[model samples]
Target: MEAAPPAPPRPWPAALAIGALAQTLFSWRVTIPHQLVFDEVHYVPAARALRALTAPANSEHPLIGKLLIAVGIQLFGDHPLGWRALSTVAGTAVVMGVFAILWLGTRQLRPAVVGALLTILNFTVFVQARIAMLDGFMAAFVVLGVAAMLWSMRAHGAAMWRRWIGAAVLLGLAVACKWTAAPYVAAAAGAFLVLRHRRADRWPGMNPAFAIGVLAGVSIATYFVTFAPAFFYAAEPLTWAQLVPFQLDMYRLQTQILPPHTYQSSWSTWPLDLRPIWYLYEPADGAQRGILMIGNPVVLWGGLIAVCACAIGWVRTRDTASGASAMLWLFSIAIWAAIPKSLGFFYYFYLSSIWLPIALAIAFDRFGRRLRYGDEAFVLLSAVLFVHFYPILAATALPGPQAFTRWTWFDSWR
Candidate 1:
């Protein structure tokens, strides 16, 4: 008979809606502890300062992140929901971006859905989204930039140029959110150059030099525009002449060794999940609550294997997408390792760990098709693990000390 008519393609609208709704539900919570948690203590006040056009409170990073947080506070008032609203939206956008990337890369809905789910359920993404931190905003922009670049690879002529511009803008905004995102911006530019070289024959009208210039120009312009308000609104109102030195001061602050931290971890231990920071832990109202900044073990451990597999696959087949992703992921790790900093924490891995879900998606797309129900099984296992770990992630009360102990799989985790 008639081969079932190819199962009638899944609607993009429906997939996007599902992904957005799931991420919103997962991240936006009304009952999330009202008291400022973790880095929220620093960022929330910075955002308030931004809203008031007062002196810059936290100059360690650029102002775009606080500006976004300020927008939330302006619209929603000063509270947890207000402080975290923009991050919640950014977190949802990240899921959408992952879906868009997989959809554009593989031209398949199943892989895109799986990738979105993986990102949505990532413990770091979930935790960061609920707090007023810069990571979620930077991550959202980074993913959008990556998706735009991937989409551009599959397009031609005007469509391709437009996508490149979009990628540059998003990546620039990412850097504006956090200077640490600079490497990702560089990675995107590098990927574009390589892709253009490989596809030179296909686009006869495209000028590589002009395209590179446009990308660089757009990125630099976007970064400066994002910083313009900072120069205007701060109490001192820094002039253009002073901006360069100001940024150097920020870099110095970042690299200098601060007072020792109890929860600090080396880059080496991040992949192994050796040390997790407890963002909050309080015993009140006859129950204990906490928000531990940790990765889901299943995704972290499994994604590591997937990244390795992608590397091997690239070596054997030279798959451009897999090779680009692997290189970017490795570059993220390498930059951190190369930096001479003694005060880094496990949270800094947020920039690198973004690739894990994408790598996992690639692995599933490439090999899972061979096994019966492989993708389905993998997604189910991740969801189950998310549920198993939700109590700790959400900071809900545990049954007792044993319940908390059971969740800590390793001594280092404890």
Candidate 2:
């Protein structure tokens, strides 16, 4: 009974193929623009400071994301590639992570590929990953946590507990990148209990109290450990006594109200694609370069309807994989509506963006079976739309000004 999980037919071969392809897309001319884009202004410098043992620049966010950026700069030298190399890696990891979630949860190959490909060709992951930002690292680790959590409960093995602990540690790593990872920790813990509960106490480590405690304790401890480097900083070296107070300071900064910006958006508008952030739109290197953080219309907008279908399928069939996908998308976005953070942006939906493909794939696989490979056709449609908007998404050379309007179907996107 405990071995019901399909451990056979390893998903890695297909998942690795997807990762390799995604790597190529993520790294192609990733060093363009010859300078930082968007919030790279904040983080690249922060990374450099941390590398030099100076004061952390963006102290409001956690240190691991910047630490990775520091590692990239250390390996590649402080340039565009240095600033963005790890982001590309993290971004590619995200696409691969999405594939793993779908494949592991559903044990379906084609649907996994379709979902991952659609996510890769979208606007948010590509743009955010190519730039020096925390979302890429945050999103990547969240996926890793979800994948590990899924594997821990379902697969029967001596090391199941290790995988579960790894999931919590990864969640800590995600929050160490940004506070946005907090919700995912809860989601992962919740998922662990739910999956194990369905199987009763047949397994050896099915103790609910211990499971929750391990998740909570391990993740909190890991989050605290990430601040170790701060204690050694040459400038304003932090002591253990200051750690809790420092975290409180960061919390205050995160929730503080700030003057509104042109692109600031509410949580409700995210699914509607009403607000798009143009991270970079300036003439550079003899051509106009524009990189907009917007969702793929065919994938992002269509995904909402598909998510609803996934919810219905979950309730009727108790499809854990499909249900998990729906919950991830919902919890990721809905938390913003309830969070104390007053200011939000289109890119804040990056986590939700990650789950859309999984939800879409599950829905298409379940509901579109009647249409015969309808999921493939939907993926193809997403690819075509991706091609149509490649220039805007990839910071490519545009024909001229107002060319952005060609893809701006809605006035709000402008």
Candidate 3:
């Protein structure tokens, strides 16, 4: 019999412990001021409604996220801190989860570390984790679902069945978190189908039957869990309206507009980093006072190059992990911008931020081959810039001129 492929080596606990340190350092600057920065206004009310079991207006997103927020409120009291507690937790989870994904994908510890560290340094992930909004939770579910799917692919026999079921459940939970997750699910399933077709007749029928069952069960449970109270009422029972209001609320939120906001940016500029939304600004109170939110210029700029690298890698070698990751990253960023919605903003690209780290990891993988001085210099330069600007990007207060200079690309940001 052919020798079984050696199992992927697990990183030492010390490396994982370092990842925890990174998570704490990056996330600690979060939760300061304890005020709702942006979308918290909408989600906070929905969380409160969830606590009271009342159907609130504009609660169109999935309930699991709101329910998570409610749990935070239960722990922290129904204030800004309470509403925001879950966001921090979810953000941290995404950090760890993404690390696990990168580790699993390439089966390389170094790449996984790079991915996690880059994710922590990114402006979008940092700010979103600190705020009370659905994006952080949505990101957590997306990455988690993707990780489960990856694990499912590597499993076999009875183990394979279990992994498939897990993947479906996670994907279903992802959809139940945000309708935006639909594209990711489709991408994953599509990727799976393509891979299965390529490997047909090599093994037992690679039907995703167990996965489908788990997906259906989890989707229904996740949906109804939010409206169990509504179902309790004898007169109303379960109605399509209950399940859909959350979606409609999200739909309306995307398309509807109120008074023009100060920092709204067109979607077109997100990829170019031409416009970025400012989440918070306060006078410097010594070291702790400075805080502004934006995507990491390193990840933002280098990520574009990484995209090109990822495309080239896929074209040359047809590596699904590299190609799919790059495709998802670009899709996550551009697809939303392409939507004909009126109220789009730079922050809508927050979840898209996850891919920057993946892109960088791919770039690093390429670097290992040639190791040219220029490539090494480029990597070092990007790392320095990421570290240098991280404080400001994560809302670290500096003198006024210092802060404004970072706002180099100003058109869409204003």
Candidate 4:
């Protein structure tokens, strides 16, 4: 028997170009309907206030997401395009990040391409990218951080340390964007440490304890640095003495639900796609338009099944890649499920959405190795679902209210 030849590396330039083009085509619409939709109303105003150096706005969330939005506002002026510019960039980064992570983990071109396409076409990523919200930026950072961690698992010496530090900073910024990203960061760190332990021979000089300490120190420092402007520019700026209490206060505020929200959905229904947040729905500019924040059913449902299969495969074969993908997905879902809130939204599923494509990619990679055109069929079905739901996802004006009902397959979706 002959040793099998190594597979050629993926074409980086072509993959990135495809990812960027997909992101630009899907999310870079500057003047579609021309109004703030959903949480854009909250975050955009916070960004504007940040630009004006006004009192801290949207105090419940951390400052980095607004800061990014503010950068867009400062550079582009406060318009639809201006507020959403950074989100567009972040969404694009997410596509590239997904590609990198899948490629690094599976070491195959087809899985990487399929996973990135699935992520790019996912309604959650696409719709969120078109708006100014913390979730898209948070999701992007999480994906990038995880990708860096995945890369670090294969590197050694200086390159490995740099990748670890990069992962920490990115994950820290993710937490600064939204606390919901914390679990994914934690899981990535755990994965990193485990990989380092398993491959200890490859990293003879690496000290796991010192490396984890560095990751923690850098992550916390980066998170606090993101709040520097908030501390510096607030009307009643907090001194070093008050900064700790301010964070504590923010934590307290997060737990205190002051009002009920009609659009809130329980975590239990997320995987089933039972409830979707109606980000926008009204008559605008002589036409009826709406933005429904819902995951594409084909991807979401298929991804869920794929995740389960990955879990089973990991248990059966002890495959590190499958195990990592399964753990990341399950942990992301568990974080949301464990949130003791009666008002969680479907968009809270954003973290799991980041890992779902990876899980699907893993499943497809295994199946494609055995069956011809398996990955292609899966990708095609996902694209078809995305196209079918594009009208509602993009707030496209319908011919009539009756036409709107055509997209609403389930009563709960309406």
Candidate 5:
């Protein structure tokens, strides 16, 4: 019987474990040059104000994201490193959450593992994770909520109501993290409703109305949990009419952020990485102080190509999983690209970084069909690529020649 073929290997647990481990390793790089480089100036001050109930009502972003930074300050002494610690953890959580999503989406380990590796090696993910920003946290919550919704779809038990409720609550949490999470919530909810309607025969006694009620409850509860501070304290002593306008004012402020900065690129050029932001750069007495920017030329360029390929493949194949993943990927990209009023930067797309891995996975899946390279080879190539680019991604002090060598791929990336 050929020794039963070793049971064909379980990929989910292994993928989850590998993703977790990679995230942990990546978290260490976060501590190098332990200081704020980019948006820390705005957020750190806001976090401090949050602690004192003096945060500006005119502030652009919502309170929940800043509150998350405050939690890191509450524990870690309110330094740059302390505030960024929250971002680091959130970034790692995104990796774990993405792994869970891949596992649930495909119900196979090979794709899950490939997805995890792609995520770990992706330059955008590396940059966002190691910085002090809300994007990482937003990404984490969005991915987690999507994973929960996917799991709820497949779960069948006496406690199925609990799973559905949990998924809804997670979606609400994602919303509280960032308004961009709306797309994920909409996608997941629509999918769930369709699945419930189609599978009524399999799920006997399942009432869509009752399920919707559960979702509503979860959404309310989660929102209250995240914003309890804002509601209970009433930091601003304004009338009810004034409060709504104040919130609108904040939104308006964010829309008109015309900051004069070098890396302030338009939305059209973002997908091409035409204007990469310089997160950090300091001079060295010797020739050691090279650029400490994120975005590996290979992965960034590869992901762009892979995205086009995935789009075409999705169109040709019409695989539901491929279509759904591709649609969500493109939707997130389109949303970021279409934001007309905000002073957009490269990091804004960090929340949708999950698409990077999906693109790469699709690329690898395509490779798997024609090439002799097996799954193990895919893993090995991913590891090699990650390691080769690890130093620059981590901002390690490399000699000028060494840094220049890595820049050989694209002058625009400089």
Candidate 6:
């Protein structure tokens, strides 16, 4: 029998600790080298363009992510700190959001803490957060929406409706940041429809037509409002007459076939992490430093098995937590396989990768107590791997010329 978790306590205390620890780690050496790394060249300049209201750069992606980056730049000026401050904040939000989502979904405390820890120890999330990137912002809002949706699903009456509205707004911001958020948005809407149709016993006035209409109208309005800033661009400013044409241009650019990249890996290979990207590996800060965007070997590899186990757990018990982990892992990766992009990269797996720790934590919550300290052991192993890989993952200066060789144990990773 699955062990019943004690009722969850207030989330604020845990959220505070997680936020503090994650913020400290994520902000460490973020200003090192004072130059753009990898995609920062594209995004940072695009953010600058947005801030200046000049000719737009990187128009293929939506504006909110860049606009958020621009806000950091506007406040802090165009330095490494300004460029990446919001990203660091977003990363911390992701960690706290994961904990809250787990708590709300499972009504369990242990799983929430473990999931947040694994998120902190995950190699890719850490690296991505410290950079000037859109994924971090999108991910933060995505989790917020998920947490809100979970709360809405579990609430009764008036509380349920308010949470639903909150979910819609957060999801709207997520979609405005990236189209990748669509699958989760769809999942939330689907859940609402099913619950209202067959399971909303405690909900009041939960008519299907009314609920669907509200969600659709609110989310769509939220998405469209993000584009309002585009109209204010000073150079060849976008006009009302050209709005539809602008969207078409963005679509055309996003779908156009591009030359394959050296670091590009197939979507199939992302879950196993068969390939990894070296965002930086050169002399920086007066020594050889590097940043490898890879998964934590212990947690990421174990997560695959845990995800399959979650599928089985759901089959046996129909536990919402188990089902959610399995479902999210499946959709997050599967969506990439179905996307029309001509090429894909390991980094694109960020969405899927975020689910691994959650899957593992749910497994621990449901079955791991058969072995004492099983969950703690798993977290320990993951943290060890994180430490071993930190030098490469954080662009920390290497100890010797041979250090890089040791870190790049896999020839393909080179």
- Model 3 lDDT, residue 152, Cα: 67
Winner on TM-score (2 vs 6) = 2
Q: For candidate 3, write residues 315-340 as lDDT tens digits.
A: 89888667877887877866675665
TM-score for every candidate vs. truth? 0.93, 0.96, 0.83, 0.95, 0.83, 0.95
Q: Tell me each candidate's RMSD, in Å, in order.
A: 2.8, 2.5, 3.9, 1.8, 3.9, 2.7
Q: How large an RMSD does model 4 have?
A: 1.8
Better of 4 and 5 by TM-score: 4
Please count the clashing residue pairs in each candidate, in the order shown: 0, 0, 6, 0, 1, 0
- Candidate 6 lDDT for residue 377: 91
Model 1 Cα shift for residue 130 (angstroms)? 0.5
Cα lDDT tens digits for candidate 6, 1-414: 998976658777877888899999999988875789999999999999999888768988888999999999999989999999999999988888889888887777789999999999988789889999888898998888888877777777888889888888888888888888867777777766654555545245667677767777777778878888888888777788887788789878878999978898899988887899988888887988888899888877899999999999989997767877888889888888888988888888887788898999999989788979999998898899888998898888887656778777688788
* Model 2 C-alpha lDDT per residue in residues 1-414, reported as the tens digit of each score: 566775557677888888898888888998888978889999999999999998767889989999999999999999999999999999888998888787777777888888889889777788887899998999999998888877776645567788888889999999999998998888776776787677564235557788789899999999999998998899898898999999999998888999989999999998888999999899977889898899988888889988999899889998776687788899888889889877889999988887888888889888878988788788888889888888888888988887888988888888
Put down candidate 1 lDDT per residue, 72-104, tens digits, no spaces. 999988987788888878878888888887777
The best candidate in terms of lDDT: 2
> What does candidate 5 score on TM?
0.83
Itemize residue pairs with steric clashes in candidate 2. none
- Model 1: residues >4 Å from true position, as ranges? 1-11, 28-31, 201-204, 284-286, 399-403
Q: Which pairs clash in model 3? A: 60-246, 290-396, 290-397, 291-395, 291-397, 292-395
State, as a TM-score between 0 and 1, how close model 6 is to the true structure.
0.95
Worst 10 residues of 2 by lDDT: 197-206
Whole-model lDDT values for every prediction = 0.80, 0.86, 0.68, 0.82, 0.66, 0.85
Ranking by lDDT: 2, 6, 4, 1, 3, 5
